[model samples]
Target: MDGTTLYAVDGGIARITLNRPGARNALNDQMIGELLDALDRAKHDDGVRVIVLTGAGDRAFCAGADLDGLGRDGMGVNDVRDSAPFRLFTAFPALGKPIIARLAGHAVAGGLGLAAACDLVIAADDVKLATPEVNVGLWPMMIMAIINRNVAPKHAFKLYYTGSRITAAEGREIGLVTEVVPRADLDARVDELAGVIASKSPLGLRRGRDAFFAIEGRPLEDQVAYLLSELVELAGTEDAKEGITAFLENRPPDFRGR
Candidate 1:
């Protein structure tokens, strides 16, 4: 609420922007809390079908955690376990709605964690990504779990160990980014994807995304069974019925998020 983060909803999409351009939109405790709050708002708002997270300014999507704000003291186990920044990472998947990261510039350390937490990430072709905690005598311990899931283990370890950076195209190759486009095309590309996703059945998106996160660590057989039941539940939703009828009638479906 300190204006370090901005949140707005329009056209069924919730836009959450980190507003600290002067600091390259670095994550501070307040900013992390604001972002988590915004995510919660969007998740509960029936009118919001999609969320887009981005940083202010063209210089950087995020330069990572604000070292000054993070301070130089080791924390007790309780403090470490209850850190607010950790909420930002977990909130995305728990929201049960699609989140797209609009990366206009570099994303390093915690910044990369934020992007990786999103369901999809679209970055400018010239943008870069890195996990440079090692360069500063620190480890990206909080984000490692997310980075591990998104990037190949060997490649991720190499980046973490060497403190190297990768271009957006390279990020796409490593499965860290979903799409890369010219800087000028970034907004259009993000809007296009958000609009397309926003037009889908909200109930379907929420249910599917929820199932996605839930079945992640399950066995293959269990996953198949759970997914089958999830599909049956989805089929019973009013939006699903309307979607089917609309398709059969060659008409646009009006989903009410039922």
Candidate 2:
């Protein structure tokens, strides 16, 4: 939408890159707006089967929110709730498609929240991650929701309270990072993963992702029931039928996002 963010689609994968390398690709209002716009576009585009979120620079995936634009007192509850970060992070999982975070550098504070929001987060092995809001006498109230879903409760609290950064390996071990690769191999790894996901039947991927998101705070029994129902529903989709036909015929399936 704007130079603050860059959006491109190629080979069924939509790449959303946060600009502003000088600021470590910080989430300023304009950048956030542009990123949200890009996400909305990618979500609706039938050609885009997968989304990859990354930053422009090698120094940091994101240094967090742009404090200069936030003013002296920073944001209040209403401001935070209305901000693009809140909407982007909270609404991401429900988009009915997979999103992968390609992190080649540090992701601190709200940056970590953005990474966690994605379905998969692949980071460079040397990357740093943290939620250091408490160090500034503030709390990562909004981000904690997404972070808690990934990290263990005690470990999440430790990151929030101590303002200490963790390595990509530790982040993966704690469930925050999906994969860790050497910096030089980050792009290859991300590409490999994106390519694999992009080859799936779009209809099945959407149904599966949506079903999983729908069961998020539900009981195990409810989750299983919903998943079973979703499976039956998916079996009725045109793409599912085509996939089965292709498998039986020894041919590649052609999914139309049906």
Per-candidate RMSD, Å = 1.5, 1.9
Worst 10 residues of 2 by lDDT: 69-78
The digit string of per-residue lDDT tens for model 1 on 134-238 reads 987989888899999999988899989989988999999999999999999999999999999999998899899999889998999999999999999899999
Every model's TM-score: 0.96, 0.94
* Residue 25 error, candidate 2, Å: 0.8
Reference-based TM-score, model 1:
0.96
> How close to the true structure is residue 78 of candidate 1, measured as C-alpha lDDT?
56
Model-by-model lDDT, in order?
A: 0.89, 0.88
Candidate 1 runs further than 4 Å off = 71-74, 77-79
Model 2 segments more than 4 A misplaced: 71-81
